[model samples]
Target: MSTQTDSKRRGQAFAGAFAGVAIVVVLAVVFFVVRNSDDSDKTSAAAPPPVATQPSAAPAQPTDAAPQPSEAAPQPTAAQVNTPPALSKEPDVKGGTGRLTKLVKTTLVPGTGPAVQKGQTVTANYKLVKYATGEVMDSSWSRGEPFSTQIGVGAVIKGWDEGIVGLKVGSRTQLDVPEALAYPGQGDLRFVVDVLAAK
Candidate 1:
């Protein structure tokens, strides 16, 4: 009976020791799991969220800035100044009657306004014809506009520069331009011109 009792006591002690070791292992595993979960939460909290990009709806408007200083506006050349104006009715002009020996100027109607000056802009209506052919070559009346040119500045034929300078604003002049004073290759020509305005 004493031997059986001693054996029973030993078995009970070994079973109790096993239970303690099992409880310690389970507690260690639980602590490790909790620590790893806390570390993951800290890492996630340190990072920032990503930003999204978007496009604008409209372009920026221009500001009203002051203009910078520059050179004076360039003056119009002879060709630009001489562009034909709107035309009027045709006049009764007779040409090709006789040969022209030199530049001839005759004022048919005297002007009541100021006489034209050199380098002044002159607006006039003219009819041009061949001295020998009575045939009309060009007429501002036929065209829809009167002609504008700078007098005595070589903007027109030499005869016109010389003949139109002294003519008043309302005068009518007849010019017989010989080949020498007219176009180089063209023959003698006749012109009846009405001065409209000069400035």
Candidate 2:
């Protein structure tokens, strides 16, 4: 009976020792897992955020050449053409026999510039008068502005196209337009023109 009781006591001690070892193994596993989790969180917290870098400014290059003077563009000068004589008032037409049958051009003031070309635009001031009555028909001077038109293009009277061509800029001239070259069915007319510009 003593042997059997001793054997039973030994068996009970062995079972309690086995339970303690199992508990120790479980606690060790839990402690290792908690420690690993804490270590991962600390590592994540200690890590620094990515930093952005700014670009550096480049150094300026030096030039060896001396400073030069800046030049301005040249401006066009007015042509050195002849200036016309000043007129005090409009001219009077005289009734004379043997009136001009063709266009008659008389330059009152000569020009020093190039002669007017065909199809070139011309700007001028003019006075138109009836040949027989000396009545002023139209005058640009009274309107205070010059007129611009392409000469020798039938834009004006035939007499003006035929007579005004070959005249230079700044020329002052008198034109006697015959009946055929003047307005339709109109009598002979006179025009005093001051050529201002041509282009």
Candidate with the greatest lDDT versus the true structure = 1
Q: lDDT of all predictions, in order shown?
A: 0.64, 0.63
Q: What is the TM-score of each candidate against the true structure?
A: 0.54, 0.53
Q: How well is each residue in 1-199 modelled by candidate 2, as lDDT tens digits? A: 9999999999999999999999999999999999999999999999985541210110011121101111221112223322345533444434323566988888887776678898876666677766776666666666555556666765555677788899988777888878677654456777787776677
Least accurate 10 contiguous residues by lDDT in model 2: 58-67
Off by over 4 Å in 1: 1-89
lDDT of 1 by residue, 49-149 (tens): 55312101101111211011112222333344332232223557776556677788887776677889998877777787767775676766555556666
Deviation (Å) of 146 in candidate 2: 0.8
Q: Pull out the clashing pairs in model 1.
A: 85-145, 86-144, 86-145, 87-144, 87-145, 96-131
lDDT of 1 at 26: 94
